[model samples]
Target: MAGVDEPECALPLDSRDVRCCCLLRSFSHFIVKNPTMNCSVQTPQIVGKDAKQHTLSPTCTGASVLGIKFSDGVIIAADMLVSYGSLARYLDVERISMVNDNTVMACSGDIADYQLLKRRVEEQTHTDSLLSDGFTLSPRALHSWITRVLYNRRSRMNPLWNTYIVGGLESDGKPFLGYCDLLGVSFSDDCLATGFGMYLALPLLRQRLEDQAGGDPRKLSKENAVQAITDGMRQLYYRDCRAFKTYQMAVVTSSGVEVRSPLQLETNWEIADYVAGYE
Candidate 1:
């Protein structure tokens, strides 16, 4: 750099090449001489107001969503908190939303992306209504459509950056629960959870399901399903950093869909005193 003039490296200015790397001998000489020196270095631009970039740092993200299928309906739950980095930015945010009369969905991750999906899905359902062919978008149909959308985005390397859980009763009155992530991976089970809930809440749901009629969701009653969801949500509040005490739950039954909000649990922190590092 002391002898050469003008830039020679490419746009990235690779440091791996000998011509680009700074010589240790030159640095040592400069250190010994203690002379003020000037050199030109190519620094790539990293920060800018780019419209195409949305939440590159993953701000305003939700935590987890849990769902289960009962004997007569399907139920899903999510906390009311949307976090901006480590700070709890929005506390009253509702992550569970109605897709149609028979379908309800819960989401975790970028709330902006979730809102975009919400509008797109609404437009899709509205277009379906315009058909007037006596056909409606069922839970499975909506889930399949969402799966394809996510998969297409993933293939383009511009994923939605969210996890979705769809729950509802199909036209035949049979309950359904499905899970899909930004990677387009999708599957349905008796119980479903996303994000931290998958690790902390899913085991409880699965155990509850297994205890009933050998993990058969159809054998589960409304009360049992609600109890399981409540228990899992409570655990998430205690364990998950992004989870909140206040949450919402949606139940899609043959009669109709009912969503309950601002639910809390009575927690006992006395057990913390027994731990080794308690102050």
Candidate 2:
């Protein structure tokens, strides 16, 4: 009673009460400094009991990523439209990105998820560069890494909701084209397509390769590959309602990755005019 101070109140000092008192004291000081402040402590609102139970779904989505490998390099393309439901929301979205000097990637599905994946790839590439001394991830290595990442996310029940086409030249300068989807299933082919591209463009690509180069991607020239990719894109714009005429394409070779300017495919409405459903 002499040396020790009396309890602030007759009530026992509980930890919760102590915390509330400390907070009130700090708020009181803040109010003293700013007398105009409205110092009212409203009851905390309970918004939700399980915020983490919500499942993520794609809002803005892209469509139909296409890629083909040729003798000199690999070419990949995707449309610029990012759609919200049936409404075309964002135009001029670059769905294709160069991952390195010899590698490029095209993605279809959630544009936001693709952007997150792109940042992860960039961070991994930068880390590899910092640690490799001189060497960096080859096209195949990058593809494998991306596959594992997608698989891991899928296993966690939070997939990226995208299909990715990876294209580049190997360290030996051989053309490489690989595909991976939200479920993490991956494979390599002379040509690859995602989303509606698989249904609408793959046949044309395979036909072009077969007709022009005996179905061997390695036998196709750069011009042939570019033409085939552009043809596929044009067809997608015509057929795939999710697709747009404005698109971006990337050519990856041993020299480097060249992402051309966004190009618009020419369209003809004459067919629409002749259709029975035409207005």
lDDT of 2 by residue, 1-279 (tens): 123333568877666766776777787788899998876789886775665652367889998999898889888898889999789999988988888898888899888889998998899889978896877667788789889999999999888888999988888889889999988999999988999899999999999999999988778898988888888988988888899999998888777988986888987778875668544
Q: Estimate, for each residue in 1-279, the C-alpha lDDT of model 1 and write its tens digit.
A: 355344575555444544644565567678678756555587877875673664345678999999999889999999999998999889999999898889988899999999999999989889988999877788898889889989998888788989999988888899888999999999999899999998999999999999974788889999999999999999998888889988999999998889998787767888866778654
> Which pairs in model 1 have colliding backbones?
none
Stretches > 4 Å off in candidate 2: 1-56
Candidate 2 residue 103 Cα shift, in angstroms, is: 0.9
TM-score of 2: 0.79
Candidate models: Cα lDDT each:
0.87, 0.86
Q: What is the TM-score of each candidate against the true structure?
A: 0.79, 0.79
Q: Candidate 1: count the clashes.
A: 0
